[model samples]
Target: MSQLQDNFGRRFHYLRMSVTDVCNFKCTYCLPDGYRPDGKPKFLDLNEIEHLVSAFSQVGTQKIRITGGEPSLRKDFTDIIRIVKDNDKINTIATTTNGYRLAKHAQEWYDAGLRRINISVDSLDPKMFYQITGENKFDDVMRGVDAALEAGFERVKINAVLLKGLNDKDLPRFLHWIKNTPIDLRFIELMETGLGHDYFKAHHLAGNDIKLQLEQAGWQFDTPAVDDGPAQNFSHQDYQGRIGLIMPYAKNFCASCNRLRVSAKGKLHLCLFTENGVDLRDLLQTPDQQAELIERLHGQLAQKKETHFLHDGITGVTQHLASIGG
Candidate 1:
């Protein structure tokens, strides 16, 4: 069992795999309207995805997060979760979804051994929700959240990407809803990628500012416990659950980053904002090639960039949160 490490000396232990790029909602920050592909790209077959996960597990991957344009959109998502959960080496199995279809699938996913779920919901207002996500089923998403809570998903995360002029006003409302629920509300700073660059000019609302607002609102939070990702978490005083803030653009957590992402096309991305990625799909066809691929992944880790230059001169290639994973 060889261990994989990145260029920054961070050991790889978590892998976020994107199953499909097809999604129903065309969010302004993710995929915009009129963004069309010339042709359908080849998606990894169920067997191939299982093989990749199994091989990665053997090489020291203990956590596997399934992501997508929306993973629930995949027909075999439940079985995919089961495959990772049944693997003895994988201790954590989770998925990130938009929650549009979670009401129907959350229980099935839980039965298949999914331990956690992260749902991307930008706003609670129906109109604002439609404006942000290009969908009008905000009530359905709320029901999905309720369903997840009932389905025994212990960690139900609500990921809200804070766009300065768009959803910034909705933060307090989001925090209020989460105060009574068991879900963990996570505020993500908008990054300069995908459709975000087209609409969002300033990625304002620093983590400290949010914290101050919560404090002034008579909500006190404990110092966040350390975690694998960049989310700085805090449990509100007298609140049942916690609130988290991921400041990727303002405060980069690249130094302690122990995660790696596999894009839908099978490229291993060392950093979210990295323009290049190492392809591993073809190499997984053979056992010998699989071992070599693992070694290469480990070697690539050492070269992981310390942080991303989102505002840099990279035109239209900045890391899109949805394309990579949230």
Candidate 2:
């Protein structure tokens, strides 16, 4: 296996694979209403996906996260999980889901060697939930969360996308839920991506703001006592579970970004905010071209932008989060 170090000397070892570009829910933050496409989405076949993962594994990739328009929507999702977990070099296999189908598949996923799961849940209130997701199935998602816990997934995480004047008022209620539930809660800052910029005025919230809100609500912050992702993890002084804040816009983690993303159509993206990507599907069709493709991939990593300028007036290169596999 080959090791590629960034300018900051952080070894890149994680790969995020978007297995599909189809999702069921239309979250206001990601995909707004009245948004339609003229044509079908480009999806990767199982064999092509497996080949790409195998190639990446040969280059020292150890952690692979299965993301999608909604990864759970994929028919061969279990098979995909099995292939990645079967790889001896892959150390972690995780998935970011909408939790719509989690209840039904949680046990199967656990049996297939999946150890981590992140569920995107924006609001806890039923009416606000419908307003955020444009769907009235809040109870279904809650059921899915309970099902995940019942399935014995050791690490279940809830991801909340915070928007000002929206669900921000429910932060305290969200924290209250976290205190009683065993799963970890994460608060994500709204990025100016997809429909976020057009419909929601990037009412960005920083990590410090979240901490302050918790304190004002009478919740004392005690560090979770564990070092994790870019998220700043904390626990209520007497709560059972933990809370995390992902402040991408305010506090950029590009320097410490240890992961790369691959679109469902087989394009290798070096950053979440960049539009340029290396097409690996074309190279895979030509057996004699794998080595050159590998070299080019390494070069892309070297050229990976230091940070994404979402709020810096740069626009129209990176596709919407749905298309880019957020």
Candidate 3:
């Protein structure tokens, strides 16, 4: 069994696979424009997804993260999970969802071999969630979070994109709320993503200043925010849960980059900030060419841009975040 190693010698262990780009909520960042549910990719079926995951696992991917505009929207999401577990002995089978439908599917997903779950909760207030996400699924998101914990998943992460002037006021509130909960609340920095100019200009928070505020407020973070993963984790003396800062814009996480993403349409994205990618959908029906696809993916990783150009004054692309599993 070979692992995915680039020319730079960075061995990758994880792949985030977006099952579909269509979503219910037209969030300001992810689907800022809009989407058509009928536009979902049917090119790769459950069997094809399983084959893709197995092929990657054979090439050294240990963790496979199922993502979508909302993975739960798929009626066969659990079927995909079951097939993935049966096809490969992946160390972890995880999924990222908007949490609108997680409440109904969390237990089934856990039984189907899903071990970890990441839910997007932009705000604890419904009004704010609606203001940011353009939907009133805040209660649904909370229900999903509670369901995930009750379902006994190994790790339940609450991912909040930190918009500078918009949601920064809720940091202390989130910190206090997580004290006795099991959620790993993480604050993700607003990235200059393909969502376009309006989204890019929304992020004005500096990672250093944010960290300083957290430190002064009495949170103790032991790990460097830029190490291993994007989030620098913090903990309080009494809080059982952990707080995280994913300073993707303020902290360069490229040095420890260990992930590659495949869009719902079957395009392989080597980096989050780049539009350059190769389509793998055309090769799925030709199983004999799995080796060729693997070679193509590995070759591209060698040329993967060391860091995103967001900090270098480069504007992002036009692809939707829901499409890329970002």
Worst 10 residues of 1 by lDDT: 313-322
TM-scores vs. true structure, each candidate: 0.91, 0.90, 0.92
User: What lDDT score belongs to each candidate, Candidate 1 first?
Assistant: 0.77, 0.77, 0.77
At residue 74, candidate 2 shows an lDDT of 88
**Which stretches of model 1 miss by more than 4 angstroms?**
202-204, 215-227, 311-316
Write one digit per residue (lDDT tens) for candidate 3, span 239-263: 8788788777665567778888887
**Model 2: residues with Cα > 4 Å off, grouped in runs:** 34-38, 214-228, 285-290
| Model 3 residue 67 lDDT score | 86
User: What lDDT score is found at residue 193 in candidate 1?
Assistant: 64
- Candidate 2 lDDT, 1-326, residue by residue in tens: 46755666666788889998787888877776523554876678777776777777878788888998889888889999998888888888888998899888899998998888899888999999988888888998888889888888878999998877778899769767877788889898776764456554645666578877766766555453211456777766577777887777665555567778898888888777747677888766544665776776777778777777766746445646777687
Model 3 segments beyond 4 Å from truth?
A: 36-43, 222-228, 316-318
- lDDT tens string, model 1, 103-185? 98888899999989998888888898898888888899988989999999979998888777778888768767876788888
Q: How accurate is candidate 1 locally (lDDT)?
A: 0.77
